[model samples]
Target: MCSHYEAPENERLLAGFGVAPDSKLPIDLWPTHMGPFIRLRHEEAREDDLPELEALTGQFGLLPFWAKDRKLGRQTYNCRSETASTKPSFKSAWKKGQKCIIPVSAFFEPDWRSGKAIPTRITRTDGGVMAIAGLWEKWKDPDGQIVHSYTMLTINADSHPFMSAFHKPNDEKRSIVILPNGLIKDWLNSSVEQTTSFMQPYPADRLKVENRPG
Candidate 1:
């Protein structure tokens, strides 16, 4: 599961994701950091109207209605696709169809093949921003303030040629679901049943990785 990533710049957000640019978000994002995500606009329109996408900044981790505080976000940043509909922290968003796309320049994962943790940056082979599948939520805090948050959706990557090398050697390999440009719209409007079709891992050949040695 990914815990750190680089958010796309305002220009990329507009050009690549087709969303209004916002310069307030930080470039580097962690579990509880606020970051931008693209989702279907929640506005009233005619039945035949095409869905509109909007960009909103939200905490990186998801906060369920039952969460007592924002601290819950850290542990809920990555939701496993296999149990999203059943997991307490993610079920509500999944059932409500609160799908979103997390636009990132790159995501970092740990490579332990050298018997040490090396940070590896993964990005699209064509140098385009990645559109990762995610779930967003709107939660009310104790102070009566509304807080928006999101969680990246992950799928098993044990068999993936590239992704399987991340994390520990003994741990189950996993990867975030990176959506193709053509599927971004369908994913935002997908029903629970259709979600399964998009949960597969991104093609290993289409991704390139840079190992950061420290």
Candidate 2:
């Protein structure tokens, strides 16, 4: 299972984000170290957190879709790479060919705080940017508040040499999906059946992991 993911707040804010139609793409801001706080209604942020976010993302000319309520994203963000077509939240998007590509310089993941763990950064070995495949949706609250959010998908680490260990920790759980630029476009535009074929190991040899940097 996947848990957390990382992206550049600046890219989401500034980039036009080329994707198919009807995709409800959602991008958050970065704090100081992380991107900006694009993740409103996090585990604590509330639903009425649009004005502030609009200001931040607007600076870079981004169209930020605020979260409607806080229930779905409170826990349901990432859908598994293998089963996204069957899940309720993702199935619709998958069927309509609604997909987007998230650009990233690297991904941040914390090693287990307990057991055999340490902090690290997983980035492209070639030191280039990556375009991760993700699904987006628009949902609303009982009061008719509309919000848009997206999730990162993950698959089993079958060939990733360094990441296989990151999939499971002693008494802890962690792992994320990192798509390379080579296959990202196809992943975003392909049919549901075609997309599943691209969920393979995500090209482990193209990535490198180490203590967090940048």
Candidate 3:
């Protein structure tokens, strides 16, 4: 699961992704911090057909509409794609198609081969921005103040040559879904079945990695 990542500086990345800039996001986005995500406000024939996209800032962890308190969101920063449609915390959002795109310049994972968690950076070899699949939810507190939160969707990575190496040696490997640039809109509007098909391993050859001391 991706717990931390570097959100792109809006202007530079939006231009690289050929998207028009809308809002600013924290350069270093953490689980509870506000981060930028893009979603279509209305249905569109094509991604570019929309004059402007909705770029909103939301907390990284998804706070379900039914959640009694915000603390539950801390454990939901990432939702497994395999069970998202059925999981209690994500089922409603999944069924309602509360989808969004999380753009990142790079994400961090723990490499545990040394019996310690080594911080490892993963990014695109081409230096382009990555669009990660995600789901968002709207929750209101007791005072009726609304809050928007989101979760990155992850998939089993046990069979992925590169992704399979992260996390604990004995734990199951997992990775967040990375959507191809042109398919960003497709993922946001996909049905449950189509969304499942998009939760695939990114080509290892196109990924670049840098390991750092924990």
Number of the top-ranking candidate, with TM-score as the measure = 1
TM-score of each: 0.94, 0.62, 0.90
User: Mind sharing the TM-score for model 1?
Assistant: 0.94
Regions more than 4 Å wrong, model 2: 1-5, 9-68, 112-116, 142-145, 167-175, 212-214
Ranking by lDDT: 1, 3, 2
Looking at model 3, residue 158 earns an lDDT score of 92
Cα displacement (angstroms), candidate 1, residue 108, comes to 0.3
Candidate 1 on 16-124: residue-level lDDT in tens?
A: 7667435568999999899999898866742447338888889999999999999999999999999999999999999989999999899999999889988899888
Candidate 1: residue 207 lDDT (0-100): 93
State each model's CA lDDT, in order: 0.90, 0.49, 0.84
lDDT of 3 by residue, 1-214 (tens): 8999998887865575445345666699778888888776664634557544566778899998788877887899999988999999999889888889888999999988788998899999998889999999989988999988899999999989889989999899999999888888888778866778888888988887865554
Error of 2 at 133 (Å): 1.2
Worst 10 residues of 2 by lDDT: 55-64
Q: Sort by TM-score, best first: what order?
A: 1, 3, 2
